[model samples]
Target: MAKLIVENGGPLYGEVQISGAKNAVLPLMAATLLTEEKCVIDGVPDLADVKVMKGMLENFGATVVDDGNGLLEITASQIRTVNGDRKLVTEMRASTVAMGPLLARCGKVVMPLPGGCAIGKRPIDLHLKGFRALGATVIEDDENEQVIVTAGPKGLVGDAIYLDFPSVGATENILMASTMAAGTTIIENAAKEPEIVDLANQLNKMGAKIKGAGTDTIRVTGVERMGGSIHSVIPDRIETGTFMLAAAITRGEILVKNALPGHVRPIIAKLKECGVEVETVDDGIYVNARDKELIATNIKTLPYPGFPTDIQSPFMAFLTTVKGKSEVKETVFENRFMHVNELNRMGADITIENRIAYIPGGKTLHGAKVRATDLRAGAAMVLAGLAAEGKTEVSEIYHIERGYEKFVEKFTGLGALLTRVDED
Candidate 1:
């Protein structure tokens, strides 16, 4: 296990570079299975999840090479097997993404149930529904807890599919599966996140005809084949938002490089509402919180173009020292407030009722040993630790490493007194 030790009351005052979006790159990696040619991706983040995805691709007879300069070359000339490693597939929720391409390529796929953070029950029923709608037979092996998807002898035939909820994972799975289907596929109520748009753009580059990505409705016209192409991943909007809040929480000034300001407009508006100054600079965004007192603000997590659910935790951590009460409502994940208890341990006044959290600000937080429940929660703990009065130790840092690349290095570059400690 690894833990992070953070010293308190240091204002981060330097430039920090944002990495590629984990959510975007994962689906893009799975998309490589759609072609037999080499697919080269640039600006891919070096994270634990990326490494896991690389290993999974290798198991399926694909060659993935990292150039150590933010470039990944992938080629899936032939698929050696339809069965994936049970342990690896079960360890990452993104592993389920492979099922779509495998079914399209091999007419069948058998994989164990996917798993990741224990935030809540993220059922893949929507994904299975979309698969079934596309003329594939889905079977549940209850005894083994595995899902089996097989295409008929005629292969997949496209149809009109409507999702009960606009799940990002389901949308990605169905969209990828439809690329090589027999006919046109219309997806209603699809996810409109920027990551979804990025995936659609990449698929288009690979010769798949996809349109209306950043909207509720998506249309995919199936092609006979797809070819690989070079593409660059988008910057991590969630990481950018986290750094912006880190500045506000510690009364710091930071310039976030390679940031897409339009993607984080909601967060920037919220920070400005809390009395933080944000400006758009060339190729980056600069945030200043020096000599500023944060004010409590109400926030509600929604889909893109609204406040992002991934950033709610770190934003909540910043609100702890505000002079008034703040209300935070989480509309995405059910168990996202798992960090409330951990934050309370650090002398924060927070009470959660159902999906809503009421935070009475102005509490002076002191250092305490806290465990990171999930990825975003781990970020919240780090932000709280940066503003607390004493030294704080954050355990279970593997969750943090799954998404963020060079987390400690980036924070240290921004003048944060944080270090990683190995516990054997």
Candidate 2:
């Protein structure tokens, strides 16, 4: 196991280059099954999640060549299998994305339930429902935790589908399947995340008709086949948000490069409300927060174009040092307050009931032994520690490293006294 030994109370100031979106890259890798030609993806983050997705695709008989310089060249032109290895599929939630492409291309697939951060529950019912609506049959083997889908003979036929919620995974599944279906498919209440838009752009490059991806309603016209092309994944906005929050918590200035400023409009606004100085340039975001007094701000987690749920934990970490009381409402997930207890261990005063969390700021915090309960929660701990009084030992750092590339390096570059160690 790895632990982060963080000596707190030091101001962090520097520039960080944001990586590709993990949320975008995973599904984009899965979308490769829509074509049999070569696809080269740029801005792909060197993350564990991306590695797992590569393993899943390799299991399906695709040739994956990581160019050793942050570029992945994948070709499924002669894919020899539709089913992925059960063990590999169960390790990453994004593996479920393979279902759409596999079924759309080979007509059948056998895969295990995907796994990832232990933050909340993910129901694949919507994913299965959309597949069924597109004329695919989904069967689950609970004993083995496998989802078996078969689409063939007559081929998939597109139809109008309505999702109860704007599930990102379900939206991706439908978008990929509809590309090869017989008729036009309209998906209502679809997810409007930048990742969804990135997937749509990639599919469009491969000859798929998809419109209005970053909106509530999406339209997809099924085509016979997709041709391969090269597309670059967008920079990871969540990573940018996390780093930007880190800079704020430490009362430091940081310029995060390669991140689109528009992608983080809501977060930038929230930070500005909290008295953090933000400047947007052509290629990056510069955060300046030399003032020690941080104003408390209320935040509510929502879908894309709004405050994202993925960055809530890290945002909460920033709120810990603000003056006065702050309120946070989580609408996306029920059990998202798992990080509250860990923060409390470090001398934070926080209360949670139902979907709302009340945080009273302006407390001096000292380091304590803390554990990470989820991916983003792990990031929250790192931010909290960077501003704490003394040494903070953050356990379960593997979770943080899984999502953030060179997290410690990023902090060290900013003159923070942080180190990674293999201590129990």
Candidate 3:
């Protein structure tokens, strides 16, 4: 197993180039199944999740060529099967996104339920619901934990579908599936994430009629087939927010390059409230907080255009060092507070009542052995380690590698003292 060893480093100060959005690029790779022609995706991060998605695509006979840097040219000229890989499905949650593209391209798909970080319970009922609305028969094998979806005899016909919640995965899956359906499909209460808009743009370039992305209601008019197109993914807002927290936690300065200021408005607003100086430049966001007296602020996690839940853990780590009392309510995931105990192990005073984390700030945290409970939780541990007093060891770092690209290099560039080591 691999573990991260972190030591108390003084304030990090430097510019770090942000990687591509892991959340956006995964679905775009799945979208490659829509066309037989080659499609090129630029700005893709080299992540474990990306590699899993790449392996899944290749599992279905798609020719994927990664340019080592950040370019992936995929050609799905022939789909060998409609059956999703059971092993791949359990490795990453985004593997389920392949269901929509495979079903749309082949009219049949059998996939196991996806599994990612165990932060909370995320169900794929919405994805199946959207597919069923599009004239597909969905059968769930609870015994084997698999889902089988097959289009009707005449293929999929578009229909109006409403989601109970604006699930990003469901929205992308349904959007990709609807692109090649027979008629118009209206999805109400769809996800308004930038990744959804990115996928919509790529789908449009491939002759898909999609409008109202980045909104609650999306309309998709089906086409006979989708062609290939080249598209660049947007910068990772969650990653940008994480790096911003890094600057705040260590009282350092960082200019996060390739960050879209608009995508991280909530994070910037919250950071500013904590007495961190943030400036959005023409191409990047600069954060500086040396010797600043930080205050505690209440935070609530919500959907997009609101405070992102993905950054809740790491931001809470920052709050541990601030003065006064701070409260964080996580309305997104039930078990996201799993990191609270790990943070407490680091000598921080934190309590959870009714699932809300209450932190009394100004508590000195000494470095201690911790674990990366999940993807974002793993990052929170690293951030806390940077601000702690001694050496902190974080185990189960594979969770961090799934999302963050060049994790050690980026932090090292920003003057953080951390290294990856093997634990036997």
Candidate 4:
């Protein structure tokens, strides 16, 4: 295992360039199974999850070539198997996305239950429901813990599908599958994340007729065949928000480049409400929190265009030093507050009752040995360590690498006293 050792009390400075979206790249890679031509994706981040997805695709007989830059040329000219690797699927929940494209191309797919973070129970029942609505027979082998999906004799016939919740993964899986259906498909209450819009844009470039992406309703007209297209992924909004919170937590100044300012409006609004100064520059955003006392503010995590649940943990780390009491309500994942115990261990005054976390601010945090319960929680621990007064060691950094690209290098570029150390 690798651990991160962070020295406290260093204010981040200088400029940091944000990477491409992890959420967008995974589905885009899976979408390659929808075509037999060569699809080139630029600006793909070099991360653990991306590598995992690439390996899974290779196992399915796709030829993936990396240009040593951020470009990936994926050619699925031949698919040898419809069965996904059980171990790989268990390593990443995103592997479930293969079901859509695999069923569309091969007419059948069999894979083990996907796994990733231990945050909460994220059921794939919604995905199965969407598939069933699109004329696919979905069966679960409870004894073997596997899922098998097969299209009917007439193949996939598009129909109306409604989501009980705006689950991002479910929406993506259905949307991709519907693109190759026989008729039009309607997805109600779809996820409105920017990454969804990015995926839709790429699919359209590949000759898919998809409308109303980034809206409550999405309509997809099935196409006989999709040609290859070159597309650059959108910048990572979560990574951008992490850097912005890093600036505020360290009371530093940082200019974040290659970030979409409009994508993180809710986060910026909350930062301004907490006495942090944020301004939009020509191609990036500038953040300054120097010499300012942060005020406590209440935050509730919701769907896109609302406060993101992904940013909730990092924001909680910042709230520890605020002037008053602050409340964080997590509406997305039930077990997301696992970081609260770890944060409290570092001297943060926090209490959790049900889904709400009460943080009494103005408390000075000290360095402590902490385990990163998940990806976002690891980031929160790093933020807390940056603002603390001693050495902080964060273990289980593989979770962090699953999302962020060059995390330590980026933070170090911003003048953070952080380093990666190997632990045995």
Residues 280-356 of candidate 2: C-alpha lDDT, one tens digit per residue: 98779999889656799999998888898989999998888989899999999887899999999999889997788
Score residue 165 of candidate 2 by CA lDDT. 88
List clashing residue pairs in candidate 3: none
Q: Find the 10 residues in a row with the least total lDDT in model 4.
A: 5-14
lDDT for each residue of candidate 3 in 354-402, tens digit (9 for 90 to 100): 8799999987889999999999999999999999999999999999999
lDDT of 1: 0.92
- lDDT score of residue 300 within candidate 4: 96
**Ranking of all predicted structures according to lDDT, beginning with the best and ending with the worst:** 4, 3, 1, 2
What TM-score would you give candidate 3 relative to the actual structure?
Answer: 0.99
Q: What's the CA error at residue 34 for candidate 1, in Å?
A: 0.9
Q: Write the per-residue lDDT of candidate 4 for residues 1-424, one digit (tens) a residue.
A: 9999988747889999999999999999999989999999999999999999999999999999999789999999999999899889999999998899888888899989999999899999999999999999998988999999999998899999999999999999999899989999999999999989999999999999999999999999999988899999999999999999999999999999999999999999999999999999997999999999789999999999899998999999999988999999999999999999999999997999989999999989999999889999999999999999889999998999999999999999888999999977
Clash totals for all candidate models: 0, 1, 0, 0
How displaced is residue 96 in candidate 2, in Å?
Answer: 0.7
Q: What is the lDDT of residue 273 in candidate 3?
A: 97
TM-score, per-candidate, Cα-based: 0.99, 0.98, 0.99, 0.99
Residues 21-112, model 1: lDDT tens digits: 99999999999998899999999999999998998999998999999988999999998887888888877899988988888777899989
- State the number of backbone clashes in model 3: 0
lDDT of 2 at 162: 98
lDDT of each: 0.92, 0.88, 0.94, 0.94
